[model samples]
Structures are given as structure tokens and as C-alpha cells.
Target: MVTKVVLNGVAIQAEEFEEEVIRQNGVPLHKIRFAFKVRSNEYHDIATLLYEKTFDVSVPEKDLNFRGTIQNYSTSVTNLYKENEVADYRLELVETN
Candidate 1:
């Protein structure tokens, strides 16, 4: 399965991404959240954009079937911007069948 999520104009690879499972109907539902670090101070504006933007997730291939939703999201800005620090986030992917 190929899962792709884009946040703040930055596209993230969702492969091997961390997922939290919530069970329903004896089935495992997954909630996946990704944290990405910002490398440049110029990303501040883009970081702010995170508050207003909704991510686009693409699953080109899926052997196992599931449904997805945006459960929650938030963002953070540093006092003094630095590289390799988290700037913002998209959403928590809630997967259900």
C-alpha cells in the first residue's frame, strides 16, 4: 500500500509511519500521526499555513481496505527558529473499515 500525505505544501512519505490502533467490531482501526521537522526559517510562513490548510492523502494501492479521517491536528513555532525542529503538523489519520 502506498500512502502519501501532504501538509503545509510539504509532502510526507507515510510508509512505516507510526500508527495508533483503536479497536471496533473486533477489528483494528489505525490512527496515524506524523511529525515532520522544518529545516529552514523561511518555513515559518508555511508553518502558519498549516492552521488553514487541509492535507491531501493518496493511497494508490491497497491490499487491505480501510477508511480514513482527520481526527485532530495542531502546530508549533519556535522562539528562535532552528533547523531540524518541528514547525507544524497536519492531522491524525483515523482509519476504519
Candidate 2:
């Protein structure tokens, strides 16, 4: 089981994680979905990092690494801009072809 995942150069502890293989037009791709928390103070940096939509993904516990694109993303709170607020974030990524 993957307990942590690295995006770009930032490492985040996973609250929930899932990995699977999916075939698209006979090509197998690696897809991962995970959940984690984001704090108000860290929101700006995270947003900036994700703005590119693609980054290096690494799961050290599984010895896996790849370049991936964001397929889906969501956050539980809209008020993360407030000081001291924390929000739950869910992200999905798929390996680039």
C-alpha cells in the first residue's frame, strides 16, 4: 500500500490512496487517486505547483515513478484562503503516454 506520494518536489502523506491499471485503446496506463489535506498557509504554493497540470509523480513505498497529468481534482472547502483553515483534497492522475 502506498502511504505517501510525491508531486513535483513536494511530498504529502496520503490519507487514502488507490492505484489501478486501465486500458485505453489497447494501451495500458497507470492511474492513481489519492486524498490528502492542505493547510491555508500551504495553499498558495500547492496551487502554483498544480497550475502546470503535469508533474513528476513518485511513490517511494511502491518504488514507482512517472510523469503524469492531472485527470481530476477536488477540494472539500472553498474557504482555504482564510488563515489557519485546512481542507481535504482529492486528486487523480494518469501516466502520460
Candidate 3:
């Protein structure tokens, strides 16, 4: 038996800042770095939220068959903020009979 979990369309939130430092020639240098953190709905939380949906494998007739075959499934998060607007995730199940 196999189970898979995926997270999609995660957003990155951060800010840009600059710092001044003295160089070898006594000249001031400016350095910049983008500081940010990843923000998104937690995968576990999303999975739990999906409980209300029809994601149950046992409910599907094809899932009950353990014959040699591969099953492909997918889910996605459509609405994301900033750079994480759209993403898709796929899962594959292989049965060894």
C-alpha cells in the first residue's frame, strides 16, 4: 500500500534591505539581500480540509483492485498570493499483484 501527499502554489513573502560596509579602498559598498519566508496553507491542514471532499481511495472501485497496474491521480490549489498563483501535483500508485 502507498500513500502520497503534495503541496502546491506556496507563496514567498519578504522584504529587501541594503547595508553599507567599508571596502579595501576606503570606499563604502552597499550589499543587498532579499529576506523573506515561505507562506502557504499547511499540507497536513489541507489534507484534513480535503477530508470533506471525495478523496477516499476505498470509495473508488479501481483502487480496490490490486492487479498489476499503475494509478495516476492529481490535485491542485488554484488561488495563491504573489508568485504562487497556480500549481499542480500528481500521485502515482503501483500495484504488485
The candidate that achieves the highest lDDT relative to the unseen native structure: 2
Report the C-alpha lDDT of model 2 over 1-97, residue by residue, as the tens digit.
3388999989988877999988888888889999988999989888888798998999999787989999999999866789999999999999998
lDDT of 1 by residue, 1-97 (tens): 3365554345555434555678878888766776554446646665565545344344334322245656776546644266655455445666636
Q: Candidate 1, overall lDDT?
A: 0.54
Candidate 2 backbone clash number: 0
Q: What is the Cα-based lDDT of residue 16 in candidate 3?
A: 40
TM-score of each: 0.43, 0.92, 0.22
Q: Residue 62's C-alpha lDDT in candidate 3?
A: 22
Cα deviation of 19, candidate 3, in Å: 56
lDDT of 3 by residue, 1-97 (tens): 2222211222222234212232535644322222322224444444443343322222121223222222343455534444534334343333232
The candidate maximizing TM-score is 2
CA lDDT of every candidate: 0.54, 0.89, 0.32
Tell me the spans in candidate 1 whose CA falls farther than 4 Å from its real position.
1-10, 13-16, 37-65, 77-86
Clashes of 3: 0
lDDT score for residue 23 of model 3: 52
When superposed on Cα atoms, how far off is each prediction in RMSD? 5.7, 1.4, 21.7
